[model samples]
Target: MKIRAAVLHSIGAERPFQDTRPLVIEELELDPPGDNEVLVQIKAAGLCHSDLSVIDGNRPRPVPMALGHEAAGIVKAVGSGVRDLKEGDHVVAVFVPSCGHCSPCAEGRPALCEPAAKTNNAGTLVSGEHRLHRDDGTPVNHHLGVSAFADHAVVSRDSLVRIDPALPFHHAALFGCAVLTGVGAVINSANIKAGQTVAVIGLGGVGLNSVLGAMVAGASEVIAFDLDDSKLALATELGASHAFNSKDPDCVEKIKALTKGGVDCAIEMAGSEKALEFAYLITRRGGTTVTGGLAHPEKKVAIQQVSLVAEERTLKGSYVGSCVPVRDVARYVSLFQQGKLPVDKLLTHTLTLDQINEGFERLAAGEAVRQVIEFN
Candidate 1:
């Protein structure tokens, strides 16, 4: 089948992406679902930092690749051996496709599924197949096994989680990445207890969700930090008890004083080594610092090694928020339905596929919270 998709031929393109135009909208051929796979007609796809990381060359992957991973759609067809989901079922695409037999999957950590990681890095489906190609037969790699920037995609069933058909596609799309990563970091990784003081660093879509998650987890204080005052205001409106500009020279001191030596759990979603360092600094003694950000592979953070021993501090890296997508997606969606999560507030813009580059520019400029490309 022919599909209109955003294809990135290279990485590290100059900013003002609207002018450099890293993502070229191209017509490509999509293959049918193979065994244990499903064909989905994408309804909505969110522009996320993970996608931006690829565009900026922070996270390198094989190209030309069809980009876009955070998405929701309807299952149009199911391949052989896929009995759980049927045509017309609404679903969210998970970037990591867990093979149940893998060590991580067997241990109940599907996010670290070895096969998924290998296939993802290789830019192929979990089954090791390339379903997208140019008219000239040049293969286009799949982005996180989703390639969701296109109208339709063929993905492994493991990459999908069935959702309530009543959920809005645009809202549901967030559950795939941002909501899962942000909220999951607090609930699963940090495991914030009632009355625990929490600090959320970076107020992008994911960081804001961390703020909301802290509230849901019954945190006594949800302090928000970001370079953008507008994002700080939005985070405050969403339930953060205090907001601070991380760029403030007194930012760390103020937070430490406010919490009497820092928060119980500090979550870093900013995808910067500096942000991770800030999160570490803001964690109280014996507290946890969880980072879900995807910084460049070459980037590293400097931390006093003795702090781990003296303060009994725990620094953990969370991927997909340490989420069991099947469980967490449903849990988060339930929270959204009950009006507790308020995931809708994170969505600030909706654009057609043609406006994708502009939407990305807004994201890159920190001008939008969460932008979704809505498909008819």
Candidate 2:
């Protein structure tokens, strides 16, 4: 079948991405689903910072790749041996496709699936093949095994999770990444409990969700930090007990004073070493610092080694919010349905695929929370 998709040929091109046109819409041929794979018609896909990282070359990937990992769609067909799901089921794409046989997968940690990581880095499906091609017979790489920027995609059966058909497609799309990564970080990684004080640094889409997560978890004080005032304002509206601009020289000192030394849990959602370091500093003695941000592969943070032993400080890196998509996605979606998590408030705009570059520009400028490409 032929489908229209966005293809990124190279990385680190001069920005004003609309000018460089980093991702160009191209019509490509899609192969039928192989065994244990499924063909999907994408209904909605979110433009996330992870995608931007590839465009800016902060997170490197094999190019000539069709890029879009956070999405929801309808399963159009199932390949041989697929039994749990069939055609017509609504599904969300999980960037990490787990093969149940792997050690991490068996340990209930599919987010750390070794095979999935290898294939993702290699730009192929778990089956180790490209299912898309250009008109001239050139192979196109898959983006985290999803390649959902296109109207249609073929992905591993392990890469998808069925969702309630009643949920709006755009809303369901976020569960695939932003909501999962943000909320999961607080609950799974930090194990945030009621009455605890929490601080979230970098209030992007994911960061804001972390704010919501802390509030929902019954944290006593939820402090939000970001460079943008608008985002800070939005965070306040979404149940943050306090909000502050991270750029203020007094911000860190203010947080410590307010929380009395520091917060119990501090989350870093901005993919910067400085932000991670700030998250660490704002965490009190014996507290935890959780980072869900994807910094440059080569970047590293410096922390006082003695503090780990003296203060019993804990630092953890959260990938996909340390989630098992099969279970967590359902739990989070149920929470959203019950009104405990008002994730819909995060959807600031909806754009067509043609407007994708502009949407990314807004994301880069911290002007949008969550923007979706709503297919007609």
lDDT values for all models: 0.94, 0.94
Compared to the true structure, candidate 1 yields what TM-score? 0.99
Candidate 2, after superposition: displacement of residue 215 in Å?
1.1
Which stretches in model 2 have alpha-carbon errors above 4 Å? none
Over 1-376, each residue of candidate 2 has an lDDT whose tens digit, in order, gives 9999999999986767777788899999999999999999999999999999998999899989999999999999999989999899999999999898889989988899999999999999999999999988999999999998989999999999999999999999999999999999999989999999999998989999999999988999999998999999999999999999999999889989998899999999998999999999999999999999999989999999999899999999999999989999999999999999999999999999988888888888778999999997
All candidates: CA RMSD in angstroms? Answer: 0.7, 0.8
Give candidate 1's whole-model lDDT: 0.94
lDDT of 2 at 154: 98
Residue 43 Cα positional deviation in candidate 1, in Å, after optimal superposition: 0.4
- TM-score for every candidate vs. truth? 0.99, 0.99
Q: Which residue ranges in model 1 land beyond 4 Å of their true spot?
A: none
Per-residue CA lDDT of candidate 1, range 49-156, in tens?
989989989899999999999999999999999999999999999999889898889999898999999999999999999999988888999999999999999999
TM-score, cand. 2 vs. native: 0.99
